[model samples]
Target: MTVEQNSAPDTAQIQLTPDESIVLFELLSRWCEDGKSPTPEASCFESTAEGAVLHGLLADLAKQLIAPSKADYDSLLNGARDRLKGNWDFPTLRG
Candidate 1:
């Protein structure tokens, strides 16, 4: 569990593994490419404070991630997804 810390004491820091960063970068890139609200409600991400935070997060992720620029980005994204999903398997039970 390695984390890269920021020297500034005033700001908060969130740490993500390489796989997590790659997966997040791909998701954000898709939202930007589509130019649509991530949710059905336009207000959810149009011009509100939540949207602002998302915008900032996307920018920061872009700076930290390089997988999006690679030719095999899709493969990388799939691999990341698998890693993040881990061993959690959905199960069905009869009532």
Candidate 2:
């Protein structure tokens, strides 16, 4: 299971499984909860230019999680868990 970002619009790809999708969704939901309005530039999901990039990355992650391969699922789950663990101190973005 490998995720790659390409210059081409349709080239970015991710591969995972149903269980992985559930995990990814849960993590994203937590982020959405932790991250509300007035998001920082680095993490904002509403910026016109950068928002598209963020959305694309998220879409790829969802696709990978929905893939049928167990390896893909494990890879995405591990990556997401590691990311969440490393960034556990994300500041509250809302009042």
Candidate 3:
């Protein structure tokens, strides 16, 4: 098996029914929209910033769902993760 395949979490395999599938997709879409622009100019649903971001998220999650490899996943997210970690992870703002 490929390294990417191995890194994926077992939870990713949970079979969602059609309804549940749509719910997850919608949640991801709304999340991207909230993070992106709520009034984005893209006319096509698939062409919206939310769509692109959500696509990337899904692709990355597919590659490394759990126990992600540093080189493949953590490395890519390191900067953002590091930047946000201090503010969100710690109780105090003191460095």
For candidate 2, lDDT tens digit of each residue in 36-95? Answer: 544445644455767565456566666754432555655766676665555446666351
Worst 10 residues of 2 by lDDT: 1-10
Of the candidates shown, which would achieve the greatest TM-score relative to the real structure? 1
Instruction: Kindly report which residue stretches of model 2 are placed more than 4 angstroms away from their true locations once superposed.
Output: 1-10, 34-95
lDDT of 3 at 46: 59
Number of the top lDDT candidate: 1
Q: Estimate every model's Cα lDDT from 0 to 1.
A: 0.75, 0.55, 0.51
lDDT of 2 at 61: 65
Model 3 alpha-carbon drift over 4 Å, by segment: 1-12, 34-95
Overall local distance difference test of candidate 3: 0.51
lDDT of 1 by residue, 1-95 (tens): 23445553576799989898988776766666567646436754555777677778989998878888999988988998998875455563221
Backbone clash pairs in model 3 (N, Cα, C under 3 Å; residues 3+ apart or in different chains), count? 0
